[model samples]
Target: MIPLRLKIETDAIEPYVVRLRSFEGISDESHHTGALDAALESASAETAEFSGATGNLRLFGVDPSEVNGDVLFVVPSRGTAHRLIRANSRHNTLLVTERCDQLCLMCSQPPKKQHIDMFPFFETALLLSQKNSTIGISGGEPTLFKSELFDFFNRAMSRRPDIDFHVLTNAQHFDRADLPILRRLDLTRILWGVPVYSSDSDVHDRIVAKPGAYDQVRRSLSLLCEAGAKIELRTVLMKPNAPGLLDLAKFVTTALPFVDSWAIMQLENIGYARQNWDTLFFDSSTGFDIVGKALDFAISRGIDTKLYNFPLCTVPTDYRAFAPSTISDWKRAYVADCADCSLRNECGGFFEWHPKVHGYERFGVA
Candidate 1:
């Protein structure tokens, strides 16, 4: 048996077993806690042939068996920090709905339930809003259930007008109907965050898995801005869209001047991710190209820009400014790649799925 070395990411909430070798080894079937040694033993050996160098290895078993070694790691972000702060965070996510006209390739939740009564969600959000200055409402698509959507929005804002509510939408439905309620909501207080995968209509439509989605999103954005509603445009980078990434940001900077800001998120590894992993995900090494270009483009236009899920790559070498933001650290993909990184503390690390699929060991110096 090849003695397998195990690597673990510590950023995880619950400790997990890291097994780099195959399960076929050793003796006592019942006595063994699977392949993991209850107590980690220690050793050192060359890890990657590419580096032609050795890394210290910690063993967690009494038996000295030979097996493949695996590396596991974790890095926390603002989102993880916030979840840690609140005791009831387990009850705190806003699953606005399971309904959405566009089928984004990365839709975290599908059109599972379609519509939801705002009361159920509002009952919970109202309590959190008291303590949180900003409450972000994410969904199968928040705009789908307009009345219930605004119903909760109204209740929260009414109770604490000082609190800011943010709603993420595909921006498909809000435009066509000329409802007074949609316009009545104070744009000054609410933030309507929109998702645009690409600028090209054809690219955007296919990626969304819905035709004509580009037109609707385009029109809704125009209407939302015209009605004086605050706007935030977001883009999630993927393999297919990597090349034209900066163009999307360029379009928003030129056309949607009303958008309060722009944010570029690296694709996470989860849900529909594995099915599309070969095409949807990009490693952090390849990612710096896309991020560096987009950041420069948005900054040239004087728009506030950000990169979530990766601060190790995004931090400025000379000086920096900090803004509060929440991001998912891919527990499934986060890599221990940033080991010995200069900006590890400030960096949120990659999505778990990212490192799981791409391997954190490959992530290296620029």
Candidate 2:
């Protein structure tokens, strides 16, 4: 589901639908070409002079690099176009690294050993992101580049003082030394989306394929709480964790009560997850009652809870409101039965990689 349109706007700039055209595809009347340098070199009377560059090209208030690819859009005012720098169809998540220490069975963006430094790209991305829009920081594990990560956060905070940050980390790398750095940042809106797979340390450790990951994350959570940092603990629901979901909820309510929110999410069938479907996939439709019970218990205890990536048809009516449209639009899809579903507009549907072999038997109109 590649989004056909992207809305780009700034504080004073009216929104514009990002128009794309290749260098060869552009008409003589079109405003842009492949490189910003090329646009400058080949200025003509009919077309608006515009050039495209992946990361460094700066024009019309935006670094074309932040746009990711060739883009054609005009701004009524100068400097206002910078707001579109981090604009993309999916939520604005600046992927900081592909390296990770833990290996979860259902990891979507699995860890890579290759030398891929995203700090520079992220620096430009953070600078270009909208000041008011929530910017997400993600990775195979963001803390791999701790100094660069904290530096980027502080810079982003100063540049876009009003924007909030949502960072997805395993929360295993947080050490006592990192506490002072976290305190330095304006953390009111910096949310750490940490994953805690199970109540048992052994189970949690096994899920992440790390012997002491559970203890590490537990320590990190305590450090974050002590620093007054906002935390959103996430659990990716699957066969291994489903039976213990209620226990995990209880653990959160009792041991980790300082967490701002709890997200029990459906597994996204992609990357390593696709290969491990037989082992990891669980039909939520058949066991929604258990899921609901876990959620109900958490909510009853006044812990903010949310259902991520669960389809409306598969969730109980009582828990429907907690289920947000969680999948990125580019990777989201709907089956034939979704055509007549009452909540189709609000549903997150399934991941594009979810094959029919693993689909739910109870899929239909809600």
- Assess candidate 1 and give its TM-score to the true structure: 0.67
lDDT on C-alpha atoms for all candidate structures? 0.57, 0.74
Worst 10 residues of 2 by lDDT: 35-44
User: What does the lDDT read for residue 6 in candidate 1?
Assistant: 34
TM-score (all chains, Cα) for each model: 0.67, 0.80
How many clashes does the backbone of model 2 have? 5
Model 2 lDDT tens row, 1-366: 553223332333432323233244445786544322224323233322333342222233333333343223334354333222324554656667788999899999988987566555455445444447787788888898889889988876787787788999998788999888989988897999999999988888988999989988999999999999999999999898899999999999999999999999988888888899888988898888778889999999999999999989988787789999989776889988789888999999888878876467666789
Q: Candidate 1, residues 1-366: lDDT per residue as tens digits?
A: 122123322333532222223233444453332233222333335321111012222333323233332222211221111121122221224556676676678765556644645455344335433354555677777777776777676666777777676778888887546446667766688888888888888888888898888999999998887788888888887777777888887887898877888877766666676567677865545455666777788878988877665444444443123222245321322246567666555566655434344533344432
Clashes of each: 29, 5
* Candidate 1 global CA lDDT score: 0.57
The list of candidate 1 runs beyond 4 A from truth reads: 1-92, 114-121, 176-179, 311-325, 328-340, 355-366
